[model samples]
Target chain A: MQVEFWFEFASTYSYPAAMRIQSLAAARGVTVAWRSFLLGPIFQQQGWNDSPFNVFPVKGRYMWRDMERICEGLDLSLRRPTRFPRNGLLAARVVCSHADEPWIPDFVRGVYSANFAEDAEISDPAVISRCLETVGQDAAAILAAAQMPASKQKLKAQTAEAMERGIFGAPSFLVGSELFWGNDRLEQALDWAARAAR
Target chain B: MQVEFWFEFASTYSYPAAMRIQSLAAARGVTVAWRSFLLGPIFQQQGWNDSPFNVFPVKGRYMWRDMERICEGLDLSLRRPTRFPRNGLLAARVVCSHADEPWIPDFVRGVYSANFAEDAEISDPAVISRCLETVGQDAAAILAAAQMPASKQKLKAQTAEAMERGIFGAPSFLVGSELFWGNDRLEQALDWAARAAR
Candidate 1:
């Protein structure tokens, strides 16, 4: 009944996917597990020091424009962040801490909107606290708990598991053992989930 | 008016794009100008000695599966080439010589099918000759002409032009100065061409 949605807060395409996944899944009568993981460790294992977009200049240029065009097509506002790929470690830990909370999706969406739409730096604790508060969570308590060793370890373990599943990208979906990478494959992944239910 | 269809012979995605472009373009009342170029020079400029797929194992593994899924969806047979990205230089020269030929579309399709679908070695003159013959061109004469210094220079210059336009991959489309990379962008590129016509 549920597909796992693996995303990273720093991933650009993951922004739109996060914004769209919930309602689209509901319409198809499928539930989704919103899992937040970091892509940094994965990229590092591949010997990339920074985003592939940054490593390849031409690809990077096309990516920014592509994101603009995609957002326009989706009727979503996208303001280029002043600093690209602001650290999402703290945000991820917060998300991991509430992985099962009913309000987690809203909190996740709030953080993504703040980063991609409002040109905000998500690495800041103030932004993370605001996202938590917006979803009616206790900002202080969640932020405090998110930094605990246990919460940090959970995030670490999830990221390692992502790499173990042969995941090399963000905004990926998993229906059992089938891995569908990219936001473009969301529908197919959901369709796979629906058919598997039958 | 025509939009530029820039493709690399060794590109897997380019296989379907080459196979489907003509019919699809004709349906949309659009004419396409098939331009043969090499990604070797482009990849080299980015410091990649081999295909990015080869340079990154995880990406490479995903690419093969992705190509299989895409080809299945398109109802096209895809056989993994014995050697990935079999040297396509000779093939591009043959294609460049026929850049304006009435039968060039069929010729391009023939080469892609030979490489991706028929388990043929495009780098071999005999195979290149066969692809030409399949399209009703004089195999010996075309292959000979394709090897001449003038013909070789045409492909070299075109590859240079593609780089000048910031093309880093295959199956790209150009509508004026706008670059649409990937087979996925084919429709959008044609739409831009149609809109620009008005």
Candidate 2:
């Protein structure tokens, strides 16, 4: 069975899910389809120009504290990004453009680490280039490819498709047509996939 | 160690939480302080006249589906309430006024069952009266007590306290000053309480 793992680079909870999803899915003999999409468009449709966490300050404060506890439990380092949500467009294009490549997973994890752990400006090409290099890809070539019209268009279509599939947030796991949202539902999603296969 | 479980009767997820929390906390040797409060005020403070799920239809659709899976897994019966977010005010008053009484837990669970399992209108006095009677309590006396000025004030104060404690949602757990939101975090909150006691 295959599980589609949808994520956005700037999302805090997606970081932990992106880092661990591969190992967890592999253990269950499930294929992981890493889908990098933009949450900006999705939120915009909901009449939100900023992250819901920012639009609602009370919820925002609780989210950060929750993230700290979640990260601590998972042994993942989390530094609240200096920017509430760095523009993840460039980073998302990189992943969406080379989604099928073997090194895509490493590059994906690298970008998440950069945004969440290292607090690097993810929208910066230089920062994205470093992530590409870390995954042993040609930084200059991939950077050029990511800027192509086709590459940009692919990411746009992916985000639109996310909405079509009933996705409202990042770090969602889709086991067939059944949607499981949030990092907390990761285990349940995987178990569902495993059980369905049987 | 003590864990304060703040819940709302109209909340769908709170059904499974209310049904299972007592046994789970007992296993951890933790005391549970049930705090029943209203979410209407909290949502209004965030400029929402309705449930966030209702204000955002996409979220509402997903929530009902999510609740179905959650209840199925826990072997808890769930039926969509005929009225979405049926008023829990009167029920809250009853629970709040008699919170220290031994029958509070059963009454709380009974009310949740009425709304979620039986699809009874929790706002109806007869419905709440039946719940109180099921717990072998004096339905007339408790219902009368729930209408007293003191009962009304107690619920109001409890809701205000929920806001002060940064509770933006229902089924929240407070272990000391640490807050854990959603029913999924029940184990984690209980674990935190157990560990903190050490």
Candidate 3:
């Protein structure tokens, strides 16, 4: 069967989960449906003007260090960003535009690495265009597509669906109606999907 | 080579960590210094009157499920308590009283199992008295000690130290000045302590 991989481009935990989910799911003979959406709107509903990490400084500090150890164990490279919870509006919009593209996985990883590993500004159109080019996709066409009203609506709808499904955080995996949150829970979500399929 | 394991008795993840940490640390020949403290003061500092799980409903739902899966994976039984984030004051004070006892580990595990696995009320003195008795400790003496001003100060000091160490949550492990938060990071914390010893 399939698991819906819900992720936000700006989420720190989503970085590692995005990098390895494909291979891990493949190992379990399970298909992953990548669902990229905005965490901004969800956080807004929770009375947060910015990321909760910024709202809670202590938790924020713990999260960064946790990311360091987590990335090290996963063999993934991570660099501390100058900006806290960099805006992913442009990148997320572009991702939603090409949700069905075959090159999407590579595109997704590119955006994540660019933001987390390279410490680049993902909100910039130029940076997002580079992410598009890296995946062998036409930068101009996809970037152009992402700006369309229909694409904007798609992102909004998916984000709304995320809330409907009780997704409060990024890197959540949906197994049937069960929502498993966090990058750490990826394996369990896949296992749940595999067992259900059997 | 030792790691300070700082945990709040009310924490759900701490339940599993407390049960397995001793054996896990012994395998690596690492000594664990268990520090029981209350999260109430810390949470209040963050402008929260309750656990973050309760502050955020969606996260709360996800956490309960996550705990279920985590417990199952660890081969431990878990029951959803009628009350969540139950008052851990009594439990914490009692744990602090037996900080140097050889039976503290088993006593701590029994208390956690009683709350999370058996869904018992840990806030009640009767329940805590039972936990002390299970470890073959003098319940009357230990409980009496927990009620003392000196014992209360000990719990307070450890909790204050946790905050000073930048510990925002649990079960956090500190190897010297470095802090590792979460039950998932338990092995990594022990590894850090072991590596530093070499």
Top candidate (lDDT): 2
Q: Which ten residues in a row have the lowest lDDT in candidate 2 chain A?
A: A91-100
Model 2, span B148-188: residue lDDT tens = 89899999999999999999998999997899999999999
Q: Is candidate 2 or candidate 3 better by lDDT?
A: 2
Give me the runs in candidate 3 sitting further than 4 Å from their true place. Answer: none
CA deviation > 4 Å runs, candidate 1: none
TM match of model 2 to true structure: 0.99
DockQ of each: 0.69, 0.84, 0.76
RMSD of each: 1.2, 0.9, 1.5
lDDT: the better of candidates 1 and 2: 2
- Model 3 TM-score is 0.96
TM-score of chain B of 1: 0.97
User: If ranked by TM-score, best first, what sequence of candidates would result?
Assistant: 2, 1, 3
Best by DockQ: 2
Which 10-residue window of candidate 1 chain B scores lowest in summed lDDT?
A: B128-137
Summarize candidate 3's per-residue lDDT along A55-98 as a digit string, tens digits: 99888988898899889988999999889788887777877777
Per-candidate TM-score against the hidden true structure? 0.97, 0.99, 0.96
On TM-score, the leading prediction is: 2
